[model samples]
Target: MSNFAESRADLESYISARVPLISIRSIEQDRALRLVREMAANPRRGNLPLWIYTRATGTRDLRTNAPTSDDRSWPGAMDFAATQFANRPQSTVVFVDPDDLSDDNSASRHVAELARLADANAGSIILITDNPLWSGLQRLGMSITLSLPDASEMYDVIHAFLTDHRGVVPIEWNEQDARRAAEFLVGVPEGTAINVLATIVTKGSVQRDDVEHLARFKDKHFGDLAGLERVEVAPDSQQVGGMTSLRAWLDRKHQLMKSDLRGTKLRPPRGVLLVGVPGCGKSLSAKAIAGQWRLPLYRLDLAAMLGQYVGQSEGRLREALDAADRIAPCVLWIDEIEKGLAGQNDSTGVGRRLVGQFLYWLQESRSRVFVVATSNDVRSLPPELLRKGRFDELFFVDLPDSDDRQEIIQLYYQRYVQREPTAELLDKLVGLSDGFAGSDIESALHDVGAELHLNAGAELRPEFVVEAFANTMPLSRTNPEQIDEIRTWGRERAVPAGRPPTSTMSGPQHAGRRVVVLSD
Candidate 1:
């Protein structure tokens, strides 16, 4: 059944059962009111008279679309509702912004009294508001949530807007583009989506680029709501020197990840967890995946979600995850995931609850939000996160192997030097920088560039790069125990990101390198 149809049926059943007080929580107040009006006029509902109340409009008979009396205040409205119930016992009264009653003790009592009267008289009082803030009414009524429109509803919204604008402005969209646009608009309200579509087509015509424009629109509107920062990934940033296994897996699932597989039994690819040494391109892999897939990227800051008030943290988390689902077919990059989830054993139990909520969403959410979580300290992570079904795969991104180092060196050289490195230089640097992470390689190359800049007319040479490598200390040498521990854990639990090291280069080059203690 359609979502609206199902909701209508459920609401009808509640009314038929004489549910006295029904609280509807929704941002779409207009839509909810319209549905309520329709239900009031339905023959199955006994054509009950519909009364509506708002702070601005006071109390009005919806059937007549006219103001009933001067009792616009909360207490006055309660008295008016009572009078109506006494006269017509089978009526429905809807209060808009009833959350206002939460702040007024007298109004709250009046609401409670009205609820009791409605129960005895077979009338109904519906409270409609964006937030479910009527705590006092909780035991007296049942709450129904009206979610933002889904993809299909969004598509219909687009179609209706296009039909409305027919011949007024040029419209260019195929079924595929329309579907994609709907996906891009998923987490937005129907009203906002219509306004966005209208604004896009206002210039001249709606092009395929409108899909990306919709993404930006969502980022601007919804990104800040849930402690998520929309990361703007450049198209040229897809290059990564290694992670052959992860790259291959992503390539295989790229199409399925973006496609709408609602009817099919196959679930979309969840994501990957990259646990390894820091500066080993774990975070880089996330950016590369989003760029490669041509999807939007968002960084979730779990630390920012902590709230001082009870349930606030969980509320923020729920909002963030819901936003992620709304902006689906995108990559959610959670860097240093262990830091976010490390407090699972804290005394307050907030950490445990947060972890539980995140895991539940990760497992149950069918949205196309592919999560790419990178962690430097795997030991700090809970075992529940490492379970098989949590992510598509767990990858171990150790220090680059020889071939990976060679490619990384060449890539950096070409990028920084504006020219490819000679094969001899590449081979020597690959051997000399053994156990160096990708960041270490880039640092060495950057130092070489700095040297060349200092000597304005000097020719760039391979020996200059070798000198820089020798002078720098890689993390492996400085934190051998930690690296060894991480590698040991990865060996048994995760797939290697690159092929096994095959170089036999003996490394006295790293000898006498300063041991800089680093913290993860």
Candidate 2:
């Protein structure tokens, strides 16, 4: 007897009396059958019957252990039901192969014929298939849904099936482990789920993320871009630095997703688009976020995805997205997105369609894969991406403010220097490095250190370091106009990565953020 109940006494009572139809989808046949039995009372004198859609040829029926043969199509399924009822006079059950219900003309004919017989015989019908061809039959009758089993219920459902069918899965499935397994399998395709379950039973164990459990992506990488601290960082990651707003947002989102099985049935925003000058912490942020989440990081290199073959690039992109989804709770970092997607076009709307496909997946995907993409230029980014739900936020990383410069200098000095430097000397270094990109400061330091080492027989010296600074020409001077333009863009559009303390900074327009410059 099926222990699971499908509905309340009232609903079950109603379904048992009438020729009720139920539609169940996904890898839960046992649960679906249990639902049917619960909704059914004692078999009717002339009409009580059941039908199942399966592709497996019955070499031996499980309950009877009788050798059964001859695959039956959907229409034949009705005949089988009628025949069984005529002989047994109890509830006659017929199994129909879902593969029989294709969209081909023959398939439609079979479905129509089955509907006719079902109406005439006063028999009950249940369509259990994934996006089945008989979905159109819904228009004829009010179809009730058998909701997908929740994570908590999946183990019980699977165990029930195995006890009677698979002869595997231990009887006592721990609640915690079962919950984890259910969560891990959520959103996986049906074929993969079955294979995984079968492997676990037959082989004694199956490691997660194996080729047998491959989600859908192949191996690939996008090009590595230089610099992360650019003012125009990722759109969603922009207006950052405070961490207050973003932290709260992330916590909430994480809770919502976890309640649905760690994003197995939930989603956040699409991906990110980082735009700005080089040398900020944009790349660092990408890595840091993944580290914080304890998720694997995959870098997608577009250049590697590109190929001489037509559609190769698009294919690689699709593969990468699938892989990310399968290995979800992971991060896919696409550095310098504009360089690859900016100019590519195809006659059949390949590029456009690819972008649309990506957006569509982003909109509908329930996987936990988080995408972090960076770009140096935003002028040509498709407008569709700027839509509200695309990403969480946008950030612009400009030159380090004095306070940030001090922090950066301190970080590097402590990293490279054996002992702490004098505070007075550090302040002077921070001042002279003003208006300079983080990388420029590094370059300046490197040049000075190199000269000092060379002149003093590679021995570190304070005077030599001072002399190198005097001789070095900061990129700030050579690229003044460009820097200003970037800073202008950073304006209010960007957030501070290293905001000055309230006591040290003023209320200037650009006081807390990376600067933005006018195009002219």
Best candidate per TM-score, number? Answer: 1
Candidate 1 residue-wise lDDT, 79-108, digit = tens: 889988877877789899874665547767
What are the RMSDs of all candidates, in order? 8.6, 10.5
Question: Between which residue pairs do clashes occur in model 1?
Answer: none
Please, what is the TM-score per model? Answer: 0.84, 0.56
Q: How many backbone clashes does candidate 2 have?
A: 34
Residue 130 error for model 1, in Å?
Answer: 2.5
Per-model CA lDDT versus the true structure? 0.82, 0.53
Taking all chains together, the TM-score of candidate 1 against the true structure is 0.84
